[model samples]
Target: MPCAAARACPSFLDKSIHPHVLRHSCAMSLLQAGIDTTVIALWLGHAGVRSTDAYVHADMTIKEKALALNTPVTAQPGHYQPTDKALAFLDRL
Candidate 1:
């Protein structure tokens, strides 16, 4: 699915680009350029600098995190059993 941010900001993005990857790249590039988080936030149309703060304080551990992201993840498909509390809530709905 296209990101909601992409849908909301058609002018800022290429229609073919996925937002998370490109957005992460853009944020990292701005950080490397020494741009302030507040400015990045405004450029990305976020409501606050806090939304952009992740890139500002990122550490070398980011490489480790990126490596983790590149690894494949597998999960066995199975049915989910909702808790009794969830069932009760669904019944109420």
Candidate 2:
């Protein structure tokens, strides 16, 4: 069949392209292009970053590259100790 011949091309071999698959492909391509997750989420009409996080979290290479680019902070991590007077003032607010 002429249609079958067209499908024989490896690029067009997958005939089961679902809408979600197309959405995922577009999101992944945008992510790989260094677009921000917030912008991608907005473009995809996601309600929040939680939805877009799946695309970012799914790709380990991006995570590794981000980690590699960050300089480690030497400052000690600790909770802020508010004085009793400051605590009382915040409580009033």
Candidate 3:
């Protein structure tokens, strides 16, 4: 957290900070900045980009944005299809 404190405000992070916390924060920041995971992995000195996958998938908010972009514009919201088993149970009820 010393790295973050030096670069920004020490009050930015409330929890106890460890040295490795900065590495994680840096990786997440890179992801938010739209840097490719592969590049981040290389920057972090990882042997393979696969090691950086955790950071790539860690943020649900990012995933939601990506999903939103991929969704068909023609598709309307709030239309959920129940599974076949659920449909059968509902019929019995």
Candidate 4:
């Protein structure tokens, strides 16, 4: 009952892979390729996109990329201009 792929591939010979592993692979591939989680959820038959969050949180590269785009808070504090236009409107009140 073993699939040919499992036989020919030495890496898969000793280990057991669940059907969900394929689902996980497909989801992770889509995620790394910049596909949205909504699409991945639909592919996996997940009722909610929130279920795909596990993959998002599981991938550390995504976290690393997010950290790379962040500006460190180590810079000396300086006066910052308030960007909230609502403040200006409130001030005029």
Candidate 5:
């Protein structure tokens, strides 16, 4: 059914999807499944993790959701309000 739709409307395939599009889709799917962005960038042959940001730029909402899911849980929630100890540690560096 999907192939038929693709055939009917080339635009549906986004003007003939290239192998890179398939690669991008695979990368995005892996990312959606909780895979690390750095790993995805490596798998997709990106020069750097920053290159992978392009795929994410198209969808900020999804990016936010991914970040929310992946963020580490702390004892307290809200934002990371650094403690005095943390401030001192940062000051040292």
Candidate 6:
């Protein structure tokens, strides 16, 4: 049966991809593009957000990028030295 299906869809056989694998790849692609998990779940016809969480958990690239984005600004360089006038205002306060 699988062989017949593969013959019917040559691209699938050429890529050696299964339908569920393709769906997972598509879902992961969408997640990497910053689309919300809720939207991904709906797009993939998942019953709940939990179903989509597996894709996110399995993709370290997306997780790494998201973690980088959430990193505190203080971790970066450049001290916040105020101008003379600004310092004076702070002193007044």
Q: Which candidate is the best by lDDT?
A: 3
lDDT of each: 0.75, 0.83, 0.85, 0.84, 0.78, 0.85
**TM-score, every prediction:** 0.43, 0.61, 0.65, 0.67, 0.49, 0.59
Q: Is candidate 3 or candidate 4 better by lDDT?
A: 3
Expressed as tens digits, the lDDT of each residue in 1-93 for candidate 4 is 667987788678788889979889989999988888899899888999999999999998887677666747785444456767978888999
Model 3 misplaced stretches (Cα beyond 4 Å):
1-14, 77-93
Instruction: Estimate, for each residue in 2-82, the C-alpha lDDT of model 3 and write its tens digit.
Output: 665655876656667787899999999999998999899999999998999899779887887788888898888654799
- Residues 5-83 of candidate 6: C-alpha lDDT, one tens digit per residue: 7778866566766689989889989988889999999998999999998988999998678777787986764445789
TM-score of candidate 2 to 2 decimals = 0.61
Candidate 6 clashes between residue pairs 3 or more apart in a chain or in different chains: none
* Poorly placed runs, candidate 5 (over 4 Å): 1-15, 64-93
Candidate 2 structure quality by residue, lDDT tens digits, 22-80: 99999999998899999999999999988999999898879867866673686444435
Q: Candidate 1 residues 1-93, lDDT tens each?
A: 656876788664665656687888998898677677788899989998899867856745554555666665774344368999999999999
Residue pairs in clash, model 1: none
Model 6 lDDT, full chain set: 0.85
**Model 4 segments more than 4 A misplaced:** 72-93
TM-score for candidate 1, residues paired by index:
0.43
- Which candidate's TM-score is highest? 4
- The order by descending TM-score is 4, 3, 2, 6, 5, 1
